[model samples]
Target: MSAHLLTHGIIHSTTDPYAQALLVRDGVIAWLGADDSADRVADPGDERRDLDGAVVVPVFVEPLARPADARDALSRGTAVVTVLAGPEDTGAAPADEDVQTVVYRHADRVDAEAAGVWLPVGTDTDPATLTGLLTASTQAGEQAYLVPDGGADAGPAAQDVALTALRSVAEELGTAALGRVRHRLVVTHSVTAEDRAFLAAAGVSATVVPDADGVLHAPVASLLADAVSVCLGAGPAGDPWAAVRSALSHPDPDERISARSAFAAATRTPLRALPDAPAAGLSVAPRLSVSAPAVFGVWDADAVAVQSPDGRVAAWSTDTRAGTPLLPALDAETALPRWRATWVDGRIAAEDVARDARDGATPA
Candidate 1:
């Protein structure tokens, strides 16, 4: 594999403006320097991609990936952390070997190791059992990602369930391992001061779901006024970007976050669980207009060129690259390899339609 010489592009070793040209070899950024040194740094056989001048950033990461969604995300330079909805969701499949996949399982009767990652047990799961799982995780050096047994409810009933459940976890995870969990403890309706205190002590924070009004302004305001570092919870929409946009422009001053902070909540807030950080140097692109959001599209047309680890220069969503969507709007089901008909294996096998588990499982 030849080293890539990227020139005339705005390069960001840390998303800051101090760097210019960069050399990528074997998928890791091998070197970074000024644009004028291209000749001095060349290996003679290296490839050259001239960046007319676009902004370069790392790849976007999407969490809770469903198997069906992995391929497209990978193609668009997004890596995924997939989940198993339940015992039924355990197992990994023979996936597109080119894509990077990480599988996680929800607590259930099945062994999480069968798939690779172990999620926390539900609130009802016995304390002894919870302790065992957590102890094993820390001993093995895998941090925990959890889904506690209750939802957000500013009301005491929900709080009771959540608090009790969380207490069970805290006792087991202990002070040290508790920090390993994602900071935000998502709730069903609201967060009481009591709930907030416990969460804070555990080195965690809470995010509340708004009431039926579909507005999170009041809850957000309430959370922040307490002098707590807080952010919006992705309500039913399940899209954090939408929530940020809405919460930032909220009419209620109390509920709003500044546009800059809102953007960080959506993009830069690190991944939820962390025994590991995102693979270094991966990046993202924003939408296709000068005034477009800098978070949707994935490349700096003028300054940066993406080189996938596998050596494939995945194309943009549109035909020309000046400013295009990294992923074009299309149906994944019908859109094939531009040559789709040949791979149909005898009409959807009866075996395919009724599988026991989702395909995040590795093949037998």
Candidate 2:
């Protein structure tokens, strides 16, 4: 966090020259000016380093084979952590290297294992042999990474192999394992349009690289650690049961019933029928006028059944009816609302209903 002055050479930021003399304070560049101008303002205790005509540019150095260097890079605020070796160099044992060591330590915290290993398929290699290798690897509890080889082209071939390996591993492991695998692809030099299309078809995850240094040696283990961090860092987005509760409050009687059924299906809980109330204020009340097909009577109370526009039967209490009470105004509401005649033998058959002398009782 202290201030420092760097002078004497061209500074490159990205692929272009940034400045001649750069002044950095609190890990940030305060000013970039001429070397003489920079020296005039330099503080008494400010650390100064001369570049001696060498290019002073930011470069990433990965420490896969060296733990001390990685730690030092981390202390210096390096942006990327890379591993430059293959699995063999790091040892297949999982504990000899930093990446594998971290993964093994974190594996016990989560119920599932996370990691994927991709092997590029070549033109000369038999397709079956590559598949078999992927299957064997997945069966041994390791996630496979795959890339496809597009014919005789070496670049495409390597990518195809990587894709094939990843897909095979995912399929062999099933859904539970699929959820845990760290999906990635491997490419020979650069990812091409054909390589991308192959990846989309295969449904595998990948990272393209030009050579071995681009390949993260213990990618599976490294990915697993990252996955754990991400999982632990994320918070719940919203309440899970909000939609079910809203559906139950729907205004339409049919929609309300449908919502209850849907909720039951989703939660695997048995639903109970709503108790019948006075039919007077029910939303499904029938109407009568020139629209009435015919007048049907219910003798227990002042009510009449009318045929709805859709040819379904409905009843309206005479007290709530306009023009005239269907039968005569009675002390209580009419017969209880019941399920449609067609659904009598369905799930609502267990409910009871009252009958009038003129019209038969219907069970819901």
Candidate 3:
């Protein structure tokens, strides 16, 4: 990733705005200092990008609109902000806009206790054909259906009805539409706290910002951030565990192991550890034996044993549960538990020894 510096702009960092310049490196904000102090802290090889005195507010750049810009923003550690506009209001294509608009309408109905429905229209089909298609689809279990130009024109009353119908359909779908359609639900105003909690519990990300009147701002940031996080495999705010899980599932085994290890360390939950003698006192060194591939195992007072598939026995302090594996500890002199002991052909490797005292040869 290329490093750059954005200078002479009103930059928003979290909740505060600063007049100083921000040094960006590898897509993160490396330093934020006064413009005059740039020479003292700025990297010599960084590319300087002047903001032309514009207020550089962070806006969530959509992948479809301009992916490179989004990448740049993420690299710069910019907090993505989104505007909550109804899908129909956004003027996106018909097919692409339905899901978003449906979600928005459902949220609106829930907030205002109104009714709504999805109005599907074919761009190339005439009014009669559109109505026929809608009728057929509705008969085939599609609810809250409407044909554009056949039901009603775009108006407040018509919109209300449409929204109400859409909400009904959403309810019928039982939240499955959310996953299937990839729609985002954003609350644009200060809703009841109970509603907010409900949304959060439902795994819907939301942001509450205050308006000029001290009212909470619409949750545009949440919606945009959700989209960005989904694409980047980063979890939404207030949910770091999901992101960690995603990192653990990375394709690269090394990355997956590293992520799992980090997670285990942070949570104080020992995962599979290498088999080795319990360290002196409270500290224990896990070692992988030469006879077995390094594997994950749990340590307790009784024993340290290898997990299934890769079976290597190491010393254990006590009995513990077998969960995930942590990072592998490497040392030249110490022999660690072989994780791949079980995978050694038809019989266990000659050097591999079962720590009967610890686990009693019980396969984890």
- Best by the TM-score measure: 1
132-173 per-residue lDDT for model 2 (tens digits): 766665555554434334311245555555555555655666
Candidate 2 at residue 89, lDDT? 40
Ranked by TM-score, the better of candidates 1 and 3 is 1
lDDT by residue for model 3 (75-122), tens: 221222121223334332223111111111211222221112233432
Clashes of each: 30, 24, 41
TM-score: model 3 vs. ground truth? 0.29
Superposed by TM-score, candidate 3 places the C-alpha of residue 2 at a distance from the truth, in angstroms, of 3.9
Let me know the TM-score candidate 2 reaches against the reference structure. 0.32
Q: Is candidate 2 or candidate 3 better by lDDT?
A: 2
Question: Considering TM-score, where higher is better, how would the candidates rank from best to worst?
Answer: 1, 2, 3
Worst 10 residues of 1 by lDDT: 340-349
**CA shift of 173, model 2, Å:** 13
